[model samples]
Target chain A: MDDQDQQLVFINWLEDHSASVMKVARAYTLNSEDCQDLAQEILLQAWRSVPKFSGKSTAATWFYRVALNTAMNWKRKDKPRRESQQPLIDINVPEPHGPDSSERLLHQEMIENLYQAIHQLPKTDAALVLLYLDELSYQEMAEVLGVTENSIGVKLNRAKKKLATILNGGCDES
Target chain B: MNLDEYRQAWKEDEAQMNITFDSDLLSKEVLRSHQSFQSMIYWRDFREVGVSLVMIPLWLLLGSMMSLPWTWYLTIPALIWIAAFIFVDRSRHPQRPSHPGEPLLFYAKESLEQTEHQIWLLRNIFWWYLLPFCISIMAFFVNVAWNSSDGLLGFSLLSGIGAIFLYVIYSAVYRLNQTAVTEQLEPRRDDLQRLIDSLERETDDENAGDIMELVAAISESESGCGACSGWLNWAENWNRLVPSWQTATAIILPTLAGALCGWYSGTQLQIPEMGPTLFQVIVGAVIPFEIVFFSICWSSSKKQKKIQVARDEEAASKPEDRIKTTSSDNGIRLPKAPALVILVLVIFLGVMAFVAIGAFFLHMKEDLNAHNAQVIKRSFHCTNRV
Candidate 1:
């Protein structure tokens, strides 16, 4: 495709699947401003790399690779934002307002806490955990992460147990 | 919480609101970042070339003041070397294709190649950089010696020794840089290589031409963790040749004894000039090494004393006086030449006195021996006087 055509195609691709990019950036960064910055950079990189696309893999596969690598690079380069900076905006995740609302709120809190725990992880481990949470099949994970399909089971199990420990210090017997 | 249950919620709850980027600005930003780095490298090279140009006249002035005809030739090669250094530095760093859009593999490969290039330069630096300079310096010294009528044999011997010493130091530094590269940067590069290879293996695409280009880019550098130590640090802790060299008894008494032994040996030799000259040269080389080591130790100890006194006063003083002074505001005081250096100087003067007396004695002995050797010749001399 011509450069303009490729750019248009990539933007359309981002509009459809850019949520994954956001997930990766949110998993990596601590604050909204940093997340927005990282997300923008990831899109910019994905757009720039369009010329080199071999097209053997689906755009989604390529996007994940680019996104994960960009997120990893961002984490590597930037220092942690100073803690004394204002505390993170509270998740005003819709106050419980109906039957079954309490359980939904609890699940929301758990997921928020899970993201916090994932961010605490070393960047590589965090990347693995993020892929697992995205529910990609082990074979798909292998393709995205360049791990053996067999090894994904072991890695995911380890990441899951670590996540469990991080979530509640492994006290949740269930 | 089992991770599988969270997947649906992760997809839904963490779904981000739409964000947009202007296309034109981003492309410029990436190119701008790359350009900035290139500019930095160019300026650094320009500064080095400028500094070398500035120093050329100073060297010529020195040569003229010293009335040396040969210094002009030396200056030309020195200027050429400065130019060559800039050229090699520029040419060695081939433009790394660092377009922001390139794969992580591209960057990893570039880093690996850059490190390898550094390793190559550092290892072979003696051959390409130092050898030519050494040759020119030896030629200059030889020419000076020939003009002055110094014995070629003695001059050659000293120059040969100096050449060997220079090579030994250079080789040692090269090996040290090499070891650091292998130990520190090599493994880091290898880890990166393994990651790249793993990614390639899964792709089933045989485009490992990137890997093949690595052959073109083969090199490494020790970022910091190396075994080299400063001279003072080495002497302070690693020195084993003379423990007493740091103490009053060792230096003072040995200074006197070395002088006496040397003077006695000179007097005993009776060969005018050669005996005393030999003693002076040996002592001369050793004295510089001794004086530097002594000064480093003396200066360090004096600083420690000053610090101790400061601490004691700080302990006794009110909080305001005891407020630790900022290093810049308190100014780093240069250490005075210790009384010990003066004592060493005195001992050196005494040794010179003894050496002079010994030389005089040798001359007197040679004169007397010649007078005694004359038999009938002396009687003829007396008759001429009458």
Candidate 2:
């Protein structure tokens, strides 16, 4: 694709699918700054990858592939530095604004707990869980992860059980 | 809440998580990052190739300026070979394909392949990187030295020093690369392999039997069965007959002591006609010193065996008790006498052996010299009388 075409497609795709990018980045990083860093990296990689898009898979699937791969490799390189740095408080927690703000706050807390649990999973499992929480089908998850659909079922089942256990205050097996 | 509720909440929260980017700025930043990434890869390649590029011309310049022999030009081919070899090897194992859009397995496998190729390049650095340079450089030095005024002596001295210097440098380079492979690349490769393995592992019960068989095969190969196990056990028993430190000390300490003693005796205790040379005394002292050292080792080994047997019995009788006994529980034992006494005895024996051997050889030489003189005198006298 030409630069102009690539830019147009990328901006359009970002508009529609920026949620997946943010979710992936948040799942991979601890705090907002790192999440933002990872998100930007994922976007950059996605933009660079736009020229290679063959329309073989859906744009969401292709973008998830780029984002997750970028995040995985980034985490691998950043692990030492991340491990050394003290985790900053997450600043991206949503403020409850509606009249049923109490209920919304509870839901927000649950989501926070869920993200913490997801962080405790192995990188692949964490990616699988993110895709699952995003409501991707087993086929899409398999495509993103490069595993068979059956393997996805097995792994996702295992990851869900592990995530539930972590949520329930059980030890992480990661 | 159920997972469905959580999923709903998660999707609902995406609206609250706003990530706005200015498209123009984003494009610019990405373009810059892409350029930087491309340059980083190019920079790495340049770092590897730049050394040869600089060195080849520099060496040529040096050779011409120094008026080195025609053989010095041979280094050009050798240097080019090194550069070409690096370039070809690197191109053959180009950086992992940047297809981030591909599956995780593909990326991981590519990363692993790149790491393995790096390891291969480093592990065999001697063949491609060091040896050719070593040979070509040494050959040039030898040729220059040969054509010089002093000839063989000059050649020997210059080449000997050059060889030592080259060895130090090449070995250090070899070690650094090997260390990089071991400490960095190998671990990275293993991590990638593990990730790939986890992704590719089959969850089907049909493959369970194959995995079990593979595990069993590995275990059998490692532990061995029947006669092989017996021999391995026997070898293990003999291998630790004496503790490693004890064995090393027994060998190294005595040799050092014998050499020191021989050096002292050869230099200080010179008997004009009967004194041994340093080399001869060292040979003589080393023989006796080794014998005495081993005798001490044998005595210690016997004591250790007795202690081991007692410990074994104790362990067998109290299998339920987890705490184990160690031989060092008794005491730290050295050769029965004080160190001073042992040293004195060792020195005495070594010196006596050296003196005896030296006197015998010196006496035989003296006698042969006298007989030759006497024979010459008799022939002269007979000639005069005739």
Q: Candidate 2: misplaced stretches above 4 Å?
A: A75-94, A170-174, B147-154, B204-386
Q: Which stretches of candidate 1 lie over 4 Å from their true place?
A: A1-3, A29-40, A74-108, A120-122, A135-143, A146-161, A168-174, B16-18, B37-117, B137-184, B193-386
lDDT tens per residue, model 2, B1-386: 45666678888888776556677767766655555455555655786787778767766765555445677678788778887887887688665355679887776766677777778888998998788888887886676455442466767886887789888999999999889888877776766766777778757332211110111110111111111222233333334333455554555577667677766766787654434555546664577567866776687679767976786566345423311111112122233223434456557765655455445444444655576789899999999999
Give the CA lDDT, 0 to 100, for residue B289 in model 2.
62
Going through the candidates in order, what fraction of the true interface contacts does each contain? 0.07, 0.27
RMSD of 1: 14.5
Task: Report each candidate's C-alpha RMSD, comma-separated, in the order given.
Answer: 14.5, 18.2
DockQ score of candidate 1?
0.09
Q: Write the per-residue lDDT of candidate 1 for residues B190-251, one digit (tens) a residue.
A: 65575567344544332321121121222211100011112222233322222433444444
List the TM-score for candidate 1's chain B: 0.45
Q: Please state the CAPRI-style docking class of candidate 2.
A: incorrect
What lDDT would candidate 1 get against the real structure? 0.54
